[model samples]
Target: MKEDTPPPSSPPPLPVFKMPRVHKQEYWSFVRLVAPSTEMPPGQTAWKTTDAELAYCLKCKTTFKYRSGSSASIRKHMNHEHPHELGSVGREAAVKRMKNALASKRKSSAVIFSPTKRTKKINPAEEEMATRALIEWIAKCLRPLSIVEDEELRFFITLVQTMHGIYELPSRRTITERMQAHAQQLRSLLKEKNAEEVDFYSLTTDMWTSRTTDSYIALTIHFMTDFFELRSYTLEVASFCGKHTEVRIRRKLRDLMYTWG
Candidate 1:
C-alpha cells in the first residue's frame, strides 16, 4: 500500500492597501493616478476590462490597473520594483510630515487668543448659573461627567473668563453630588405635585430574574393631570431577595406606594 501525503499549503493572503489622501505629499511622490486606457503602449500587454482605474509609477515605466478603484496593485508593484526607495520615503516621511503639521497647528492656535491678566471676581449667583448651565449641557449632550477635567474644554473656559468674570470649573465629584441631589429634589417635587393634582393612578410592573438567579422588579405609575394630560413615571426598580410569592410581591408594591407618597 502507498503512504498518504498531505495536500500542499495555500499561499498567505495579500495585504490590503488604501490610496493615500490627496494631501499626503510623501505618497504622491512615487505614485500618480491616470486616466484608464484599454491600450498599453506598443510593447505592453493587453489590458483587462475589469480594471476600474489606472495608476502609473513615477520612478519607472510600469502602470497598474485595479478593480473597484483599489490601490493594492499599485502598492504591490512598488513593493517589488522599488522596495529600497519606498522604505526610505513611505512610513517615516508620512510620520515626520504629520508631526511637523501638528507642531505648526499648535503654534498658530497659541497666537489666536491672549488671556487677559485683569481677573474680576464672579458673584455667587453668576457662578451658580454657569455651573447649572454646564451641568445641563453635559446632560443634554450625554457627555461623560469627567469632560469637566478635559484640558481643551478648560482652555476654552479660560478664554471665556478672560472677558467675563473668572469662576472655577466644578470637579467630577461635585457634579455627581449635585446631579444626585437635584434628582432627589425633582422626585420629591413630583410626588408632592401628584398628590395634590391626581386622584387615582394606574400602576404597571415588570419582573425578571438575572443570570445569577437574582430577581428584580420595576414599578411604574401612570396618571392624568388636572389638565387631563396623561403622564407616566417610573417609581422604583428594586431587587427582590426572597421567593417571588404573591404575598411578598403585594407587600413590596404597598411599601413602594407608601415611600412615593
Candidate 2:
C-alpha cells in the first residue's frame, strides 16, 4: 500500500549580513580635516560623503576634523575643547625661540681654536750642513780609537761602488771570518789592558732573525773610564731555545760576562 509523506519544509532562508554605517560626526571627530572631493578614486569604499571636513590643533599641535550642517559646529567644538590653542603666531614664535637657544648653546661649547703649534718647513741646505757635520764628528771621534782608518773607509767606499756596478764587496763568509778575528783581537786587547775586570761596563743585548732562518742573540759590552768616553766592542751571538728557561738565559749571560774578563 502507498504511504503519504509530508513535503519537506524549505531550508530556513540564508541569513543576510549587513555592515553598520559609520556616522559623519564620529569619523570627522578622530581624523584631521582635508579638502573635500566629489570624485574619490576607486577602491575607497569606506568614506561615503564627499563633503567631510577636518580641523588642526595648535598645541601638542595636532589636527582634528568632523562633518556638520555648518561651520558653527566646528568653531563651537574647538572653543569648548581647545580654546587656548587658537593662534598660530604664538606657536611659530615659540619654535623659533627654541631653535635659536639650541644654536647659541652649541656655539658656546664648540672647539673653535686648535692648541697645537704648526710645524715649520725644514731648509735643505741647513739639513745637509748638519748631516756633514755629524759625519765629520763621528769620524773624528772614531779616529782616536783606531776604529775609523783610511783602509776601513776605503773598504766601505768599495762596498758602495759594488752597489753602483763597479766592484763586488766581500762575501758573507769572508765578512763573518773577519768579524770573528776582530772580536778575538778586541778580547785580547781587553785582557792585556785588564779593562775587562772593571765592574762598571755598560752592556746592551739584542736578538735578531737572519736571512738564513737562524735566531741570534748579540751582547755588546762597553768599557768606559770615569771620564766620558765610548769604547766600541764586538757583539757575541748565540742560539735561543724555549725549554732553556730563565736560569739558562742567566747562565748564558754570565758566560758572556766572563768572556770580557
Best by TM-score: 1
The candidate that wins on lDDT is 1
Each candidate structure's count of clashing pairs: 0, 6
User: What is candidate 1's CA lDDT for residue 219?
Assistant: 91
TM per prediction: 0.33, 0.31
Predicted candidate 2 versus true structure: per-residue lDDT over 171-217, tens digit per residue: 99999999998677655655655443455767888766668767667
What would you estimate as the lDDT of candidate 2? 0.53
lDDT of each: 0.67, 0.53
Q: Which stretches of candidate 2 lie above 4 Å from their native place?
A: 1-155, 158-175, 194-199, 210-213, 232-235, 242-244
- Candidate 1, 1-261: lDDT as tens digits: 996542222211222223445444444467655434535657745343333365555577455655554556656777788875665566578658655665665565556454663334589999999999999999999999999999778756545534446677799999999988867766766776677787888999989999999999989989888788899988788898899899999999889888887
Cand. 1 TM to true fold: 0.33
Task: List where candidate 1 sits over 4 angstroms from the true fold.
Answer: 1-176, 210-214
